[model samples]
Target: MSKSVPSFLQNELSGSVMTMYSGDYGGVEVQGNIQFSINYVQKLREFHIFVAQCRDLAAVDPKRGRSDPYVKSYLVPDKAKIGKRKTSVKKKTLNPIFNELLRYRLRMEHLRTQTLILSVWHHDTFGRNSFLGEVDVDLSKWDFDHTQMNYLALKSRPTSSLQPSDDRGEMKLAIRFLPQVSHSPGKDPPSNKGEVHIWVKDCKNLPLIRGATINPYVKCFVLPDMSRKSRQKTRVLRSTVEPVFNHTMVYDGFRQEDLKEACVELTVWDRDKLASNLLGGLRLGPGTGRSYGALVNWMDSNADEVALWERMMTSPNEWVEDVLPLRMLTTAKTVMK
Candidate 1:
């Protein structure tokens, strides 16, 4: 006898597989299914997901009396191994809460074919890590622009493994481009050459450290020249998520035409005694408004960054402001460029 499927599942899997097995034939019994959905947002330039938390996790370390768990997520069809992210380790716990956000710079047309893979793992100090369970979600089935929180029951890791959360915080930015216009002898211009001014205002909803606020800072880069001289960073704000750095960085010798070939990349990082952890980053260029041409890594095309630069070149006098949400830095292949 065929079991009746739920209306929602029936509608979604209309032409797909829908089956039940009989125990008399030695078929395996289905105990339960995981129930989790991602809260996703499609921005003009990127796809964002907020991985809230996991509940009722299965115990993978019963021998040790408890388990230290963390969540690893990835976006599938990533042959280059670029779309992967991990949450901070939560020690000795069954239910791990990871209020973390993940992002990918994918085209809208290609988004429907993507799949999101989330797995829970048991971390070990001296030995290999253990995989507890996993979940796979189809990006095409998710509703865009709305927040959906789901509780997924742990499931066995699938045989064919592929790959890969949301807004924990937001940052405000102000940008202005000054052109080099000739003026009268008596009246002096602001300077001889042009300049680009960037102001890193403040951030909100930053993740906490040990129940206390985090010391955050902003780093700016004018790519494809990532040299030390081309990079600028703000002073680390002590013990606060919302740090106001009305700080302004002036890039001298900035030409109006440079906007056509150049981009501004801002990344947020948490200050630590040893090594700072990247919080999130934003990239702005002419390509941002029209195409993602300049957004691709320069090494991929074996060409200069100027060849693909495209959007903000037309309006030099107009000041633009962007409210960017910060997401965790994932795989090196994804964020290195």
Candidate 2:
């Protein structure tokens, strides 16, 4: 009986194999399940799994080429002998299934070239303390760090430092999301759930080998009064969720040939007990708007692509940037008032 794995992971692994199997002579292929541990290959699979999940978040199918060229496996070819009569080595051709996988790999590589702007939101503890987040990065910068140095060593460079611009095109990313206090909004909502969707142009838009995580179950303390100590003075609180994020850092072929856009429905919950206690229900904090403000400032001040900031603001659909106004930049640090 065959087991089932998620489509996202399948896309991710396919992309990884494409990234690693590059060479001048010919391409590499996978055969039977048995072999020495292909640790690098496994890493590629894990990264795609994460990419698939994020694609789900954005409601995009980042693995669009799954049905295009197809994928297949074959036995490794034996090397030609020196002394014996040279045998005619008929180059093996890719079956339709394998071609689909190859096409997916190429497509993802293209996406890896185009930079994606990721907007991440953190509804800390509860819905009351919601804050904004985003990452503007170019996927062209990605590469194997170790591989770069080794290549540099062969050339006898005085130094083998990998400069930001060197492979920054592969995936140069940055993230900023404000911590907040909020309450749990039960599963259902009047409209869409409080959650936000996330999608990347390609695997390079992600950080590393797998998906990111948000730790929502941690505990904390909220004090009614700092100096006045009494039974009512302290309250147990839910801490910020620790998120584990990952994506395909590299691909075996150009993006257009291999990967697809990924999508997911947002699933954030409201759980701000502190705000509930004070406001009788969940309410936005005074400084909450500042999160977007700071993001805009960063985009204007730090992003090389200024049009990204502008495009985000004008998106017709209420995108993440739309909810996070660029003017929230004026808030002084931490003074939520």
Candidate 3:
């Protein structure tokens, strides 16, 4: 079955904005022997495969177990409903295709020594096209100024053995990756079979509309956030992210008690302009803007009630025993124990 243009979204592409940028790879051939670059193709393919994985996600029960998992939230048709909100969700078990998406999104959001736009592009000094974005201080490049970085920095491991067995019992190639430490080089060395998997969900039988690609699922795990109160005391904090790949996510890992005890602490910084030398320099986009506003709003809401705030502003305390509320002392002790 050849994939047809989605009838629901066909009108979205009718206007001049849509037409000016040819979405198809072949249609937008330009000078410098550049079509869409390999990086773009890889991202496009991963996104498409994500859609294909949801086909299975839609068929299963999300709450039952980890069977067809994919980070299905973003793919939730903008109109669909989950709970009280119109959010994207699919019913399925642990699907690798979706899991990879979740891992990357979480990793990108958490590791922020600096910020970068993942999907945006830029042109080169030689008049060639390029991806435009910045890397974290951990990652360096000579083209930091001219080249904008895409969100996807790590190259995916490619091979047939990477794909997991699909809904139809067909085994495909797919690869799974762990976040790299700073010392690891750009080129990732391959591992043994089943270490990674890929499931290209494109049916050759279908016509050449955009085909869906599926990713292979490896394991279900949590990314831990480590915080240190002092040089002596360290805390291993765990946050529960609703799995992006699998929307019908319900697990015992995060309990009602955890929810009751969990509260995010915000630190609001006044907006500061970027240095002229830096690319795009300290501009706030939607994420930073919202974060800034949210921090300000929270401070505004609780400015007077929060104790130790004014004192801390004047002096950084070495021994911090005075900040606790009487109500939370018991609860805090129980939690720590």
Candidate 4:
């Protein structure tokens, strides 16, 4: 079907209207549209998107005959780098109201070439999920500094595979490094070693599982060697999206030079009876070569992460506290074991 450009968007487009599709489930057709808001916070260098609601969705259920729909969104071209974000599934409803916020850490220059992709899906419990429809918007054309609300029409999936977004949640932390140096004139200088104090403060906007809240915890590790000895965790908070840790861990016995290569990794996990699920993680360190000071370079394009690294390197003796936004691992290999 030919897509119709909304009158409000006509001025934004030069001469061609963007193509969109109506969602079709088996033979049952429905007119679907998504309502959302977008804004970029300059101080944080992040894009915040709120998926408010989706209406007139196609029913894709086979046995019960009602759809359990959820919305997944991501930035195009570098979908693998930014990861994907998703809303909770609303059971047996064609009109699902998510009201969920997703965030992406990106620079203003990088936003000029990026596109936003939002997809709706039918989540099946007993079988594989089915894709209902999607919407792609050229973010470069939009004014991100000013908040904008959009009612976008849904279309068929642009590609076969979908990359998940980084809407899971975020962690708050305070990192301090104390160098082992002698103050007394006569006393021998202490060994070339220091202590790293890490405080896992809290978490926010965690994802839901099976319509219930998660038991969230923070896991900390000193990287290069993510061995069992270096791993420490906070007590799991029961049934809450916003979890308060306020726990501190100290890593001693390492030269001041270790700051150049060593990094502190903090991961959030949902504590399950059998196996815990990885929610997201944050990495802090010094930039090496072309790599962004943290998390494999590609993930640390935001100003905050790079600034934190600069502070640590330039002022190793002073304490630094930063509210580091957490992001999901782009690939399975990046997941914290």
Candidate 5:
């Protein structure tokens, strides 16, 4: 179930995944129109993109009669996984109704520097995905307050080295930074110590151990400090796939700058008596590949995780919550980097 991509698309996507925004409207036929709406809510400081549908799309596979089209999007100049958003594939159809919402959390000033590019593709199970068409929207031209579908003409939009979607279940939680200042008249003047609240509500669609139920528990570590002192765990809920452990792990003595430098790694595991089985986990941080002042490998948070963290960091005392997809872990290596 594979198809060769168009030569032009292959050429454009060769050396890079998507280095667009260079006015490279490479010669591509106008084959479709995408319907989507844009809205910006000031309270949450997030931009919500409602991708409605696509009509009269081109059939790349004429013998197959239609295409397996899906939408891929991201903000320009920052293709870091945190900025990318995608929709599920619609099989063998010329018009796909995708009532999906893609969100990005950022302040107004940061949004101005970015361009939103939404591209359509034909998904191939074993081969490279074929490019269909795309629409690049200027973040400033549309009215942010009102919600109305924009029928943008899809055109030749170069390339995107894409990755297939994964279903490793999702974790829901709330994060908040409550800045603290203590005054005892003498001692140590004043410190910018703050408390980070991570409320692990529960997990949905957890996997089983071996055709049997799993006793799942969650573990947390505020990173750069994966020490024993920083290791915190929640009680295991037995014989359940979807476990609800209304637990909160609080890490204190962190300054305002420390929040910017630190990453939160939360993992799900099956407590087999004294031993453990790794189900999956997620990292919440800036996803910069480097943290503090050094180069490290643990800053692997995706766009959704980064957005949730950014929302919590910017909102200060407010509780920012989101459901983030967990990454599946296969092996329990000697150490986690």
Candidate 6:
């Protein structure tokens, strides 16, 4: 089946935005293929791939049917900001020649758990970047001596056989904690109580349902209280995987100290008229252990989750934001473990 036209959203405050869904890779001629050569530079203990070119790339600009193409590479699971390397953008071309080298410095042991990812994207000037198709090669299965130019057909992001399914998508979340009752512009007075503002900006590359149609929404719960009063959700945005819900959810009547025992869980769901399915979610708090004098599994978060939570808790009255990747939440129950 051919892919549908991508959704274009523009915030007057922020100008034009570019978004591409996971389903955009349906048509081979449109989503396209990337040419590259991979080799291990043994002398420097570095792995490098030369992004040769991208052919028949998708036209991100629906009106013009044009694409400003670029190639980006990452060592899987470490798709962190610092880990990705990109080629210069070739303006308004479906077939762009980059001929750029992207390298990764690591040891032999690290390669055991790594996968080489080469993704082509359409660069949008004003707002957010859009994803095209990609090709993944598990490093553990590759031969370092094979350095011939590889012509591989690109496809949507593939689930890794090496690791558990964690790449559902990414959510842009901005959190602010008002630790005290204070006067701030465009903010609630809290009536002598502290407040937590959850800014659900948007999501990118959300999981696709059948026919590439999804009515996605964001669901939130402030934990230990999984009651109806504690649950809040955003309006479902139809069709697009990159749904922008620039809405804020506010919770009050808590003391500054209470944040230590609190956990904020944000989940992304595909809202069907009949039933909604949980795509993925994230839990933000200090981490696994006792919360409110009780141990719970839902509060179990690590790395980026704990860091983001601590950043918000420490910076009172300031927005502490981060783009956290959504992970597979195992359980359906909202109760404590």
Best prediction by lDDT: 5
In candidate 6, the residue pairs with backbone N, CA or C atoms under 3 Å apart (3 or more residues apart, or in different chains) clash, namely: none
Candidate 3 wrongly placed segments (more than 4 Å): 1-215, 223-247, 253-337
Per-residue lDDT of model 1, residues 1-337, tens digit only: 0122212221111101111110111111112223344543444456666667666655555665456776666666654323345667788777667787766666665777778777767665443356667777778886665566666666765556442333335577777776764446558756545777787888765656434557889888665455577789899998876777877786766665556555566777889878787666555565322212322332221011112222224556555665554544331223443
Better of 1 and 3 by TM-score: 1
For model 1, the superposed segments whose C-alpha errors exceed 4 Å read: 1-109, 114-168, 181-193, 209-211, 287-312, 330-337
**Candidate 1 C-alpha error for residue 46, in Å:** 12
Residue 109 of model 5 has an lDDT of 74
**TM-scores for the candidates:** 0.46, 0.17, 0.14, 0.52, 0.55, 0.58
The digit string of per-residue lDDT tens for model 3 on 233-332 reads 1111111111022111111222222221112221111111331110000101111111211221111111111223233222321211121101101111
Ranking by TM-score: 6, 5, 4, 1, 2, 3
Per-residue error (Å), model 6, residue 32: 13
Residue 82, model 5, lDDT? 39
The CA lDDT of each predicted structure is 0.56, 0.18, 0.18, 0.66, 0.71, 0.70
Q: After superposition, how far is residue 219 of candidate 3 from its true place, in Å?
A: 3.1
Which residue window of length 10 is worst by lDDT in model 6?
A: 8-17
In terms of TM-score, how similar is model 5 to the real structure? 0.55
User: For candidate 2, what is the TM-score?
Assistant: 0.17
Question: What is the Å distance of residue 206 in model 3 from its true position?
Answer: 20
Best by TM-score: 6
Return whichever of 1 and 4 wins on lDDT: 4
Instruction: Evaluate model 3: give its lDDT.
Output: 0.18
